[model samples]
Target chain A: MIPYAELLGLSVEPGETAPTYVMPFAVDVIGRPGFLHGGAIGGLLEMAAVGALKQALADEGAVRIKPINLTVDYMRGGRDKPTRARGTVTRLGTRVANVEAVAWQDEPDRPIAAARMNYLIVR
Target chain B: MSDSETPAGRAFDPRRLFGGRFGGHGGRLGIVYHDHGEDWAELALPYHPDLIGDPASGVLASGPILALMDMATSVGVWLKLDAFKGHATLDLRIDYLRPARPGRTVIGRGECYRITRSIAFVRGQAHDGDPNDPLAHVAGTFMAVEGYW
Candidate 1:
């Protein structure tokens, strides 16, 4: 688990390819009444993206990562329920990595939020 | 701040809305309502050790800043509409111009430029101290849960 991921109380679920991140519903993560904060959801997506990128580069040498920018789209208000997120690396170049992550509550098919992130990778 | 919710025609006082121990994420991070105007709102996030992303650098994480801007912009939408209506973030994009200065309060100011029937457009910037030198730039949209009447 990443440092920020642990702060958000996120845990990695066992998976073959890309690990899924689970964030349980709690006061520390809620936004308005009975809903999750957009920031928390965004953070979760980012952590998922980072997790995927790390896994993709696990075989390679150590690299430092920094975020360039992020765009988060909230499709639905996250209700009082555990949310799950997973990321996909669209492009992995020498200097940068483009990742996209989706977060869902009840069903994977129905995503509550999605985010696109660009990261600077330093070798 | 008054305990009552602002009347429909009056300006919204975010301080009152956020008064007392915040129960959720906003409370956990100690997000406070700073100031506002007819179409804009500002919120503050005080630096804390737990909010740091890189302890070595002592710079705050981007997640807390994102949350601050999210709430600030949401309030801006409400202030523009002149009424509290149910809405959700449609999309938000943040460009990290620079990391916020450690141990300094970061203030996020959000403005609502336009509002259609269902969509509100917002833009904002975050800065530690100097507004001219902003730490982050954000642009986003919010959609009403129910049709705007």
Candidate 2:
């Protein structure tokens, strides 16, 4: 299995309401001139959402889950700097769980991106 | 356009750009350059069967297309900005028009509609054929950085 650090290049942090993940934006992740590549942001969001789901499962005394699909909406241009993402579990059913997350740089009010993802929970 | 002119004014050759080996998904998916005077750009794809997903069904795989659109839109911005440093994607919304045709190559062409000091906006489409009816449509925004790359 690929280490989480290698997969996402970030460490996962646990919290009460949600879990947070931090990723540093660098020149390698840049796309055009001054913008962060959309794919990189998508990867970051996916990792954060998945990490949150994993943590939530552990909290509920459950095990075995995998990502099924993820859909992201871009709200604003992401700046070239470190980014923080927080994920919340909106719903947790027996077979499936729904998650929502928002990623931002310095401004929380103005999010760089938002995403809703679904995971399949195994028994 | 003359033989001495840059290749931008001429039609794009996909084989030359996407052909040969690549390091990984990131390298293959990275957007290199667009045909200078044209709307199309060269996007690479690392060798990964997972990216092909359903081979029998011939789906071009959403993950790679997502990467392709991301790169295409960024190049669209670079075309307009002339000289850009770094930018972040503010938003990227893609509407899958249909299942991509299988066994054939995929190409993306994007156009920058507007830009400002802080943000650059773009819209583009991806297709295997017939640009008029694309396999996917994407609209996104990128934030400009303070320096150049």
Candidate 3:
């Protein structure tokens, strides 16, 4: 888990390609009675995206990461259950990286939310 | 909502709901209601060590700022609609203009620009001390599940 990820109570679930990040339903993550807060889901997606990006760039040596921007789309209201998220590096360049991530509960294919992020990679 | 639903039936007071207190993610991030108006709301994020992203830089993470704007905009929608109906964020976009300075409280202000029967359009800005030099800018939409009456 990343340093900031711990503040959000996020954990990693090992997978074949990239690990899935899990955020349990708790008071810190809830909004609107039983629904998950949009920001929490957004944070989870970011952690997952960064985790995946780090793995993808492991062979490239040390690099400093800075978030350029983020866009999130909420499809379904996340219920009172643990949410899982994973990211895919859409494009990894020398100076920048584009990543897409999805968060879901129950299944991976049916995502509750999705996020697209651009990060500046300083080497 | 039924056409018969009156404004009095759904009247909302953001001040009462947020009044210097925060629960859920807002509380976790130490966000507090800063100020509000007829169609806008402001939230404050105090500096904390745990909220730091890059240890060497001592700057706060973008996630907390995003949360602040999200809640602020949600409140703005309520203020604009003049009601507390069930609405979900359909989409939100944030552009980081610069990193926030450490130990300074970041203030996020959200404004509801327009509204329809099903959606509310919003835009906002976040700044540490100076509004002219903002740290981030945001635009988003919220869908009313109960339908904006």
TM-score of chain A of each: 0.95, 0.86, 0.94
For model 3 the local lDDT of residue B90 reads: 97
Q: What share of the reference contacts survives in each candidate?
A: 0.71, 0.17, 0.68
Provide the TM-score of the second chain in candidate 2: 0.72
lDDT of 3 by residue, A68-113 (tens): 8999999999998999999999999989999999999988889999
Candidate 2 versus truth, CA RMSD in Å, comes to: 7.1
Regions of model 1 farther than 4 Å from truth:
A1-3, B1-9
Worst 10 residues of 2 chain A by lDDT: A1-10
In angstroms, the error of model 3 at A87 is 0.6
- Ordered list by DockQ, greatest first: 3, 1, 2
Q: TM-score per candidate, in order?
A: 0.92, 0.56, 0.92
The number of the candidate with the highest TM-score is: 3
Q: List, for all models, the DockQ compared with the true complex.
A: 0.65, 0.17, 0.66
Candidate 2, A1-123: lDDT as tens digits: 223234335656777866788877665455444666566667677667767777777766647665555667877666767888888889999999998888899976778888887777887
lDDT per residue for candidate 1 within A6-112, as digits (tens), equals 66888898666578999999988998789999999998898888889888888888788888899999998899889999999999999999999999999999999
Per-residue error at A89 for model 1, in Å? 0.8
Model 1 CAPRI quality: medium
lDDT of each: 0.87, 0.63, 0.88
